[model samples]
Target: MATATRRSSRLSSLAESISSSAGSTQTPNSRKRKQSPVATPSTPPQKRQRPAKLPAATPTPSAVGLMAHATSATKKPTNPMVARLADPQTTNATLLSPETSRVITHMNVAAIPSRLPQPSTTTATLLEEANAHLIKVDERMRPLVENNFCRVFSPEGLAEAIDPFESLASGIISQQVSGAAAKSIKAKFVALFEGDRRFPHPSDVAPLPIERLRTAGLSQRKAEYIKGLAEKFVSGELSAQMLNDARYEEVLRHLIAVRGLGKWSVEMFACFGLKRMDVFSLGDLGVQRGMAAFVGKDVAKLKNKGGKWKYMSEKEMLELSEKFAPYRSLFMWYMWRVEETDISTME
Candidate 1:
C-alpha cells in the first residue's frame, strides 16, 4: 500500500506541472491557455521596404454634375492638314507665333549650293571635243574670234537648242519684213501647226496648197522660198549634207543657183546651222561692217585698198577667213550680235 501511494503521488505532481505549463501558453486575459513566446533571430526585425512613391493618378470625379459641366466647355479639334496647306508659309514662321503674324516682316532666307546631275558619256565626249577646237581657235585666232564673240558664243551649248529650225526659216521670213512683223507671222505659223511640228519635213509641208500656207501665215514670196527649198529637199536636189563635206565655194555656188537662196542664206546655214567653221560670207553687210569695225577703218577705204580681193566680195571674205582660219563661224556670231548692239545703241 505504501509503494502504490507513492506512485500515485508522483503521477499527481506530473499532471499539475503539465496543466500550469499549458495555462501559460494561452492569452493572459481571455484565452484558456497561453502560447509560448517564439525566440526571434538576433538581427533586428526586417521592416518591409515601402515601394518607391509613384505619381498619383488623376482622380476621376464621381460627381456627374462636374463632368457634364466640363464636357460642355470643350472645343472640337481642327483639321490639321487643312490648316497646314492653307497657311503655306507655315514652315517660314516656325520661329514665330501665329498670333504675332501681323507684326512679323523680315524673312529668314536659307541658301544652299547644288550641282546639276552629271552629263551622259556621249555628251561629255562631244563637249570635250568641241572645247578642244574652241581652245585651239582661242589660242591661234585670239584677236578676231575670241575678242568680240568672247561673250556671245559657246561651243558646248546653243542659244536656241530646241526646234530652233526657225532660225533659217526666220531669216527667210525676215527677208524683207520688219523683225517684229516676221515674229508675229511666225507665231501664227507656229499656232497653225502644233507647237513643235511647225517645221515639218519638206515633203510633208510641200503637199499643202501654197495659198493655204500663206493664209496660215507666210507671205507669197516667203511661201514660195520655203516651197522651193522643200521641193528641192524632196527631189534630193539640195541635200543638207552638202554643207558637211563640200568645199565652201562649191556649197555657195550650189545654193545661189536656187532662185531666192542667196550667199547670205547659204552662209548662215553653213556657219550657224550646220556648224561649219570655214564659212565667212563677205556678201553679207554685217560682215562688211564687222570687218570695218575691227580695224577701226572705213569700209570705203577698205574697198580702195583692193589689190586681188580686199572688199566685201566673196573673194575678199575667203581671204580674210583664211587669216582667221578655224574660227570664222564664231566670229560671224559675235559680229551679228555686236552689230545688233551697235544698232540698238545708235537708235
Candidate 2:
C-alpha cells in the first residue's frame, strides 16, 4: 500500500508540471492572435483601396486627343527646305522654294563630283565595248540599233575645240532658255565678231562693251557673265591648253569659277563639246527625266508638291548612273534618245 501511494503521488506531480508549462506557452500566442486580427483588418483594407484608386485615376483618352496634344506640344521643323516651303517668300511662290532649290543644287554638286576614270577605250574600241555593255544592261537598246532607228556614236572634235572661253560663253547663253533660242542667240553673238568668224574669239569679245553683247538677246546678267568669261581667257587664267591637258576635276575647277557656268553646263560642254567619254550631270533635267522614263515610272508621281514633280535626289540619280562609269557620256546621250522616243516603245 505504501509503495502504491508513492507512485500515485509522483504521477499527480508530473501531470501538474506539464499542465502549467502548456498554459505558459499558450498565453503569448493567444495575445498575438487578438492583435493581428485588428491590425490586418485596417492595413490590408487600406492597401487594397490604394491600388483600386490608382487604376481609376488612369482614364483612357482617345487617340485623336492624344495626337492633338502631342502635335501642339511639338516644335516646328528645323530643316531649311521644309521651313521655306511652309512659309515661302511670296504668296505666288512656285512648288520649288528658293531655299529648297539652292539646297538641291549644292546637294547635287557634292553627291556627284566632277570626277571619272581616264578614258581607256580608243574611238575604235569604244563603240564595241559601249554597245556590248548597253545591250547587256538594257536589251531594249539592241532592237533600236538592229532596226537602224538610233545609233550610239562618240562625239568628234575635242582636240580642235579646246577653247574654254568660247565654251563657257555658250554655257552662259544657254542658261534657262530653250535649245533653239540659245542657238539663235549664239548666232547673233557670233555675228557681232564680224569677219565671218564661226564664233567670237576671246580676244575680240573681251574688248567689247556689255551693251554690244546685250544685242545678242542676252540679259544684263548674261552679258556680264560672257564678259567675265572673256576676261578670264584674255588674262590667261583660263587657257585652251590647260583645258586640253588637265584632269577631269581640274577642268571643272577652272570652268566652275566662271559665274554663270554651273556644273550641269560644264558637264554638257565636256560631254558634247569636248567629246569627253566619262562626263555626267546628275542635275540635268533631261538626264533625270530620261532616267525616270527608263525606270518605267512617271516622275510626276514621285515626291510631288503643288502639282509639280521634284527632281530625284543627286545620290539616287548618281547611284543609278554609276554602273556606266568611264563611258557614261555615251550612256547619257542614249538616255536623251530614250526620252525622245518613249522607253516603253523601244522593246
Candidate 3:
C-alpha cells in the first residue's frame, strides 16, 4: 500500500508539469510578435527612371562625299513623284505624322545646315537667282527639270572671253568636226605660228601661205576665213575687250562683219565664247531636238528635207525660251544633255 501511494504522487507531479508546458504554447491562429525590422535605413522609392536619348545621326563629311559619288553613278531619277519622294525634307513633310516629324526635327535640328545662317552671299545669291528661273521652267517640264542639271548649268571657264582672236579661230577650227579631230587640227595650226613667229600681230597671219594653213587640215574655204579673220583683228576692227563691252546686238553685228562667220558661228561665239548669259540659239539642231524631246513632241517627219520638218520652229523656240530669260544660256547648256531618241534624230 505504501509503494502504491508513492507511485500515485509521482504521477500527479508529472501531470502538473505537463499542464504548465501546455499553458506556455500558442495556437496556430495567434498573431506573430512584431520584432522591429532590423533597422535597415529605409530608402525612398526611386522616382520612375527614363531611358537615355540617343544623339542625332549626322553623316560625316567623308561619308557624305562617298554618298554623293555613289548617287551620281546611278541613273538620275526621272519620275517627278519619285524625285519628290526621295527628298528627305519633302518626304517627311508629305508622308510622316506630325508627332514623328516633330521628333525628327528635334533630332536633326543641329545637323541641318539649311537652317543655319549662311555666310557666303555670292554663291547663295547666284543659286537663288538661278533657282527662281528654273522653278518657272520646272512648271512646264517637271521630269527633265527635277532630274539634276546643276552640273550642266553651273558656271565653267569654258565660256570665258579671254582672247577674241584665238577664241574665234578655235571655233572656226572646231566647225563640222568631231572634238578629237578639231583638237588635232588646232595643235597643227598653233605649230604653224612657231614657224612663222616673226611678228606677234594678227597681221602676221596675212603672210602665211594658204598651202601652209591647209597642211593643218583646213579646207580651202576654212583657210580663207582664217586669213580674213586675222585681217579684221589686225585692223583693230574687232577686239575681245570691245565685244565684252558691247551689247548682244552689237556683238552679233561685229562678229557677222567677218567674211566667213555665219549666224550659227556667231551664236556659238556669243553663247560660249563671250559667256553671254541670255543668248539662245534656234539654229542649233541639238537644242531644237532637245527642246522637242523635252516638250514630248515629234521633232521631224521622215519625208521632209532641207530643215523643214515638224520640229519646233524658230518662233516657237524663241517663245518657249522666254521663260528662262536671263538664264537662257544655262538652259541652252542643259539642252545638249537631252538624249536624241530615234524620232528626234531623223532628218
**TM-score versus the correct structure, for each prediction:** 0.47, 0.53, 0.54
lDDT (Cα, tens digit) per residue for candidate 3, span 1-347: 12222222232233333434446463222334544444446865445433242221111111111111111111232221211111111111111111111111112222437777643322113333555566676665444556644432222221111345555666566655544676687677767767542212466566788888899899887788888888776676775445645577887888888876666556655654444557776755556667777678753332234624335767888887888877776677566546321111100
Candidate 3 regions with alpha-carbon error over 4 angstroms: 1-128, 141-146, 150-161, 195-201, 298-307, 340-347
Pairs in steric clash, model 3: none
lDDT of each: 0.41, 0.49, 0.48
lDDT of 2 by residue, 1-347 (tens): 12222222232233333444557454211322322234654565433212121111010111111111101111222231211111001110111111111111111112333594433444334445666776777676675345443222321221121234444566567655644676688789888867744455567787889999999899999899888887887787876555544677887888878876655556555554445567776655455656677777764345534633334556867987777666676667676554442221111
Error of 2 at 236 (Å): 2.3
TM-score of model number 1: 0.47
Which regions of candidate 2 are displaced past 4 Å? 1-120, 137-152, 155-164, 176-188, 194-196, 215-217, 296-303, 306-313, 341-347
Best by TM-score: 3
- Structure candidate 1, residue pairs in collision: 25-33, 25-34, 25-35, 26-33, 26-34
Q: Which ten residues in a row have the lowest lDDT in candidate 3?
A: 88-97
**What lDDT would candidate 2 get against the real structure?**
0.49
